[model samples]
Target: MLPEFPMSRQCPYHPPAGYEELRKEGPLAQVRLYDGRTAWAVTGYDETRRLLVDPRLSSDRSRPDFPVLVPRMAAAKLVALVGMDPPEHDVQRRMLIPSFTVKRVNSLRPAIRRIVVERIEALTADGRRAADLVPEFALPVPSTVICELLGVPYGDHEFFEEQTRRMLMATSTAQEAAAASAALIRYFEELIETKLGEPGEGLLDELITERLGRGELTREEVASIAMFLLVAGHETTANMIGLSILTLLEHPGRLARLRSDEGLAAGAVEELLRFLSVADELQRVAAADIEIGGRLIREGDAVYLPNAAANRSPEAFPDPDVLDLERGTRHHLAFGYGVHQCIGQNLARAELEIALYELAVRLPELSLAEPVSQLGTKPGGSVQGILRLPVRW
Candidate 1:
């Protein structure tokens, strides 16, 4: 029998060969999390999609009756858009939606592609042959893209990077992640202040000034939203670049497809996000009452919708385990559904598309330097990320 995996450390991304066994067992499986709390993991595509949009499934965990699975290390009062239900959640999400519109995000694509190409060019230059792509390229690519859009100073990339690193490292204790998050919040607060005083041209500054000009949002609200945008903006795309590269390296045929079909790069990124399924799990509380997967969820019951598992469910994608770049790319829920879908997804798509295109065109000879198993994965925390990826052309 497989050992019980906890709700906290249960990494669906850390699956072994033939991991489909877990998804096939059922749509809803009980997981014993690292904290020993039982979490219901949803695996069906429709089920997961429905769960995300259901008004009955609440994102707020602060309800005294509904206990959260893990310490809410990332937020206070959980004002996060992802951690909310309608009305309140809608308002918070709508506040950031304008900044992440396709038009706004598309304007950043040229700049994003420039950064990806420059980084890749730098990586292969001046007699330096091989370097860990994560730090040198993968991590910074998205970070630079987000910083540019947010108008946050790139001078603080090192600072943002350190905090992001500690934020996701496997061994970082809850206190460590909490400390890093606090530091991030504090840093954003200072940045917001500077943006307020200087009023430079970037998303953060624009957002602050716009909201302050209107009576819609306060100074603190602007800071909090800016902080959320920065963290979510960079963190998810960073995982996509690394994990997508690894997935391509593991499947040369797909990588070759990306090389030949430049137009397919966007869909390729979506497929990779689905196949790699790096976002892993989401936490929510039942808002009222709902029956899902034949189980009744009571009001205020904590629930976890495992995005990784649902991506692999056969009922959703025909031959679900297969990573076909040509498959139904639009159906993937790597971005959640309804009001809570990632606001920065359009920007993320541009970033991922550019990164994959650059990697495919530039590093046609690239392959893993060692067995994939040698790489480490963090089973818990926010983003499902690899510790190191050794690669060479």
Candidate 2:
């Protein structure tokens, strides 16, 4: 039996580089959450994937004895959209997925390209030996594009992004984090009101006029959807951009190939998403007693599927940790697997392709100022990727 882990000291997002040590011991491990709760982490790929799509893994922890990492109120509020079981989750996810399909994002490709191009050009024009690409380029391109796609005004983005950062990081206190979430709801609350008065030619507008008119969503549901998009679209893409830069710079040969051959760009993004896998571990709880990896799980036990670990699972991928762009990178689970895979994956790909293509082509000399081992993560527990990535053209 594995030893008991004290949760009060563990920050799953910042677990040490040797995490696979614990994971390899078994698919299931007793671990500590930041709040010191006793929860289980499910680390095996086959078993983890099964549990994610398992109907019994309840996402709603609002029940008095709800299964989760935090208290009912906080967990439900943070994961309300992604955490709900189906019928409830199915309807909400369906309403949002159409807006993020490849067709829709492809239509916005030229616009994504334009946004990416402008930022890279600005960085190149500065002509510095090193550039803080995180804010200068990575952060803004996705922030503004998603806003336009969602029909939010540019002025509102700065505020939204600030509040999101606070919400994502541990930089803020619990009270501070709550306030930021409330402020965002207020902003989205106001946006929903405006869209009601005069709808525009964007996803959120169409969602309101067409769906709400047809009784597809409630007013609160609309606000929740808008809130979900704003948080996910910006932060996930921002990290991808920042992490991809770090990934390429960490491997100059791959960077050179992308710079020299435009054909490598698409495959490279997939490879980077696979290699970096910044989304890291995803969680689910066992609904009832089930046998996995030959061990029986009791009902209500929480499971943590470390996608980063699984993507690097040697059994699943040959020599898994290597960053091989030409390795026919199709089987990786960066976007996840089965029913609960990322809904915004298509949009994320579009944004990454546009941003990365422009950066590689324009900044032919793009390289990192510091090694990957040295950078710190952004505060708050929400987003964790290569935090401060410096680059040069």
RMSD, one per candidate, in order? 2.7, 3.1
List, residue by residue over 1-393, the lDDT tens digit for candidate 2.
Answer: 343332211222233354566676677667665555556666676776777777776666454435434322252245546666777877777877777788887888899888888887777674556788888888899898889988989777789888777665644566666777788878877888887888797888988987887898877777777877878888888988887877777778887887777677778888777766666556666678877787777787766666666776777778767787777676777787766688888888888877877787777776767765567664323444766777655
Best by TM-score: 1
> Could you tell me the lDDT of residue 90 within candidate 1?
81
Model 2, TM vs. native = 0.90
Q: For residues 33-64, write the lDDT of model 1, one tens digit per residue.
A: 55565656676778888888787777764566
TM-score (C-alpha, index-matched) for candidate 1: 0.91
Model 2, residue 126: distance off in Å is 5.5
